[model samples]
Target chain A: MADRVRVKSWMPPGHIRTPAYLRGKTGEIERRLPAFPNPELLAYHLPAPDIPLLRVRFTMEEVWGADAERPEDVIEAEIFAHWLEPA
Target chain B: MPHDHAPHPYRPDQDGPLTEAQVTEIAIRELLIEKGITTASEVTAEVEAMDARSPAQGARVIARAWTDADFKARLLADGTAACEELGIEMGTLKLVALENTETTHNVIVCTLCSCYPRNLLGLPPDWYKSRAYRSRTVKEPRAVLREFGTRLPDKMAVRVHDSTADMRYLVIPSRPEGSDTLTEDALAALVTRDGMIGVTQL
Candidate 1:
């Protein structure tokens, strides 16, 4: 089976890489990126640690439900590991 | 046609006092110069180099992919490295080339901010950075493409790549039909910035 993941719905203050629109959505991992420094910490000048990055692909139906323009369409976004959990 | 309109709203940057962001930018640049971290000439040269990059670079890549199947495979596999192989410096920008096929159309947008493939395609266009383009593309992409005069059939699936984080996207638009006999340079000439951005098809 393909790897499935869910984006965390946490709404914390300060610099965030996960967009609000993508929160709580489930998607398949399209590709994995080489680890990158956590921008949330880097933005505040904190010592940052590297974390896994993923390009997740979500269908329009999954994101917008009945309101989707074309339910079969898809949207892909880069989400950090901290913002994702195995689905 | 030159004097069709009477007048328009004045541009703030040209007439009004500098904004806080502008002031901060100037202050940092001045500080860098004072500290000898960089020179004024270096800054000018950097700007010149940036301005030199245009859609032409992207056009060249698309044309090559259309003509060479092996190059297209390499481009799809590793966008940054493949671009470097063509003498295009990708810098630190991690690139991913999204291919448009017969059944799918790929469009790129940054809902958070304008995260573009700048090194390869120069600066993002003004419309690409607009609040409307950023917000609506993901919500009602078909309508957004319609505004750009692109009307895809219902059978074709649209893939909107919201470049929210690290990775940048470049749409490898499907090669137009009936251009097989044309030279690679001629093929490159047919590619346009908007088409590469996926707002319109070539």
Candidate 2:
């Protein structure tokens, strides 16, 4: 089963791990990585809960739209589970 | 058996005044030393250790992997352990080698910061640290790779790995054709920093 997900478009202030451009972009889950402490909370030296990290794969066309040089190309990013929603 | 030498005059302005960041850094270091948290010699030793590392070390590893099949398998299996076999200390950071194949390609970038395998490949290039590269690479990898003069076929899949956490990635570029007869030293010579970073294809 392909776990296709869309990156949530949330802009919170202060340190964040997710990139701004990936907001609302749809991609497939490539792999599941070991859970890591949420960096947003870790930055403040607070105890952070471990979150599932997934390697998401997106076609260049999906990410860059028509501006993509090679539409067939793929880009993989490790995104936290909280930032993902079903596409 | 001593010869008299004239003492040079001290010129305070020979070097420009330190910037705000530099002043803050110096003050912090002084405070740390005054509090006995660390010594100046210890800091100097750490700096020297970092200075001793360079990309030549990574190139040597790649050359060996290209020549030895078992080594290549090990590298692909566990990058950190494979590098340790070559006497490269990875410290606490996990290093993963992304092999480039005919159907797939891999590139690495740190979107949040300039996170790189400095211990293996030395200091990153200036352009890699630029905001343009970091911001644009994720959104437009194919265009960025093209700008780097690495144009792949339209059918090939380009997988971009974002170094967002503790793990670091290194690209094991495809062995150049017609170079089977080259010695390991010669092959290592062909590996470049950008190639390992996946900005350039060998």
Candidate 3:
């Protein structure tokens, strides 16, 4: 089970960890990927997906900052359940 | 009372900026050596191998993904297996590959730290690992893309995907149109390192 969130808008700071670079964007849910447990935890120390997730889509101009001359671009993207607040 | 005896300088609450895990990492490394389970030399060798292999491998994967559609499809389905097929081997890393199509583009960044698909794309470009890139990519994705010379339409949809937890992501860009008749080698040649990151097309 996963939570959902509707990200209204993004304030892409010059730098930070939040996928703000991907904010104000939209894409289709391609497929559910995997998940991760709290990294600080011990016992089960592996890089396997502990939970399920969904990937999305975007264009180069959407995420990478492309110019107009060379257009018609896109990129495959993924977002986890943990990352969403609520839509 | 004599102005509170000369008034203390207004030093903003500077709590000696060492509470983060960086300090803990040093402590852990010292402890590891003290326990004799490992030596600094052993750790350094492994680190060196990882460092040396990262970027070159990334360039190769980016180049390969750019030129191979079947390979790209496999990556979209199962990144880990797809990587192994390429001889890059995702190994213990839970890999995920994303495609930047004519409709969408993708970029990756670790806001907390530089969590990248080193095994596949190799070492991340400095910008991809930067805090600005990470933060802005999600919020002002279009603006960021603009910096990269990528601009989307007002009507065109822009989606931002965040890479978190065990799963990592790779951007598989669409093959450029004029590249239809080119050989795989030639196609690979046109795949810029940035293309793999979804910053630009082939």
Candidate 4:
């Protein structure tokens, strides 16, 4: 079964991995990627703990709504675990 | 405002005017070298190594994949290892090859920054780093692809891969039709940088 999750809309001020457009958007988890040090913290030269990353898939309609050129098109993004919440 | 006429520290003919970011980079580099963090020769060697990569390397990989089924399987399964089969050193970074099929097409973008498969395809083009391409590709890919003169059929599904993490993506474009008689070298000649990036098809 695919894990469905929504990106949390947390707008912190700094270098971020998650794109702003995908924030608050729901998507299906495609697969789990290997864990890596938190880039958000790494950018600041802080000790960054390892975090799980997931490849999430969302339809064009979900991201752009009526403005989407092709509603059936799919987009995948690599998002860290902490940025996602169960939809 | 008190103005003093002084010769600029930067040699006009050799260095030109450095941007603030470039000046900061120089400062950091000099500090690191001064502190014995790294050597100037090490930095120069790294830059030269990066400069050696080009799209031709990627084209050769694509050509081999087109002709060899087992190689193609290995490429799709583990891109980094597959590249090594042809002696293309991918270093420690992970690479994923997305296959374009009859029903699905793949495009790559790094919305947060200009992350790319520099090991295979050299430095990314200026347009790829532009704000318009970065922001618009995710929102409206079809229009963007169209602008690049790559029009897909309405039935074909477009899949845009956002390279947000360390894993770099390389699009394995479908082989062109009616080229069965061509050699691997000839077929490789047909592959373009844009084709590998999924902005256009070969």
Query: What Cα-based lDDT does every candidate model obtain?
Result: 0.88, 0.83, 0.59, 0.89
For model 3, the stretches where C-alpha displacement exceeds 4 angstroms are: A1-30, A39-87, B1-35, B62-68, B153-156
Candidate scoring better on lDDT of 3 and 4: 4
By DockQ, the candidates rank as 1, 4, 2, 3
Question: How do the residues B31-94 of candidate 3 rate in per-residue lDDT, one tens digit apiece?
Answer: 9999997899988987886766544454455556766668777877777887787687566877
> Ranking by TM-score, best first?
1, 4, 2, 3
Residue clash pairs of candidate 2? none
RMSD for all candidates, in order, please. Answer: 3.7, 7.6, 12.6, 7.7
lDDT of 1 by residue, B1-202 (tens): 0111246455467467888988998999999999999999999999998988888888889999998999999999999888888999788988899899989999999998899998877888778999999999998999999988899987889999998778888999988899989999999888887888888888
Which of 1 and 3 is the better model by lDDT? 1
Q: Give one digit per residue, the lDDT tens place, for model 2 in B1-202.
A: 0111235355464279787877888899999999999999998988897987777878888999999999999998788989999999788757778898887778889988999998888777667889999988877787899888889886678888888765788999888998899999999888877888888888
Per-candidate iRMSD: 0.7, 1.8, 6.8, 0.9
Best by TM-score: 1
**Complex DockQ per candidate:** 0.88, 0.63, 0.15, 0.80
Better of 1 and 2 by lDDT: 1
lDDT of 4 by residue, B1-202 (tens): 1111234264354366778878899999999999999999999999998888888889899999999999999998889999999999899868889999999999999898899998899888778899999998888888899888889987899999999987899999999999899999999888888888898877
The Cα error of candidate 2 at residue A40, in Å, is: 0.8
Worst 10 residues of 3 chain B by lDDT: B1-10
Fnat per model, in the order shown: 0.91, 0.66, 0.18, 0.89
Per-residue lDDT over A1-87 for candidate 4, one digit per residue giving the tens place of the 0 to 100 score: 239999999999998999888999999998788899999999999999999999899999999899887898989999999999999
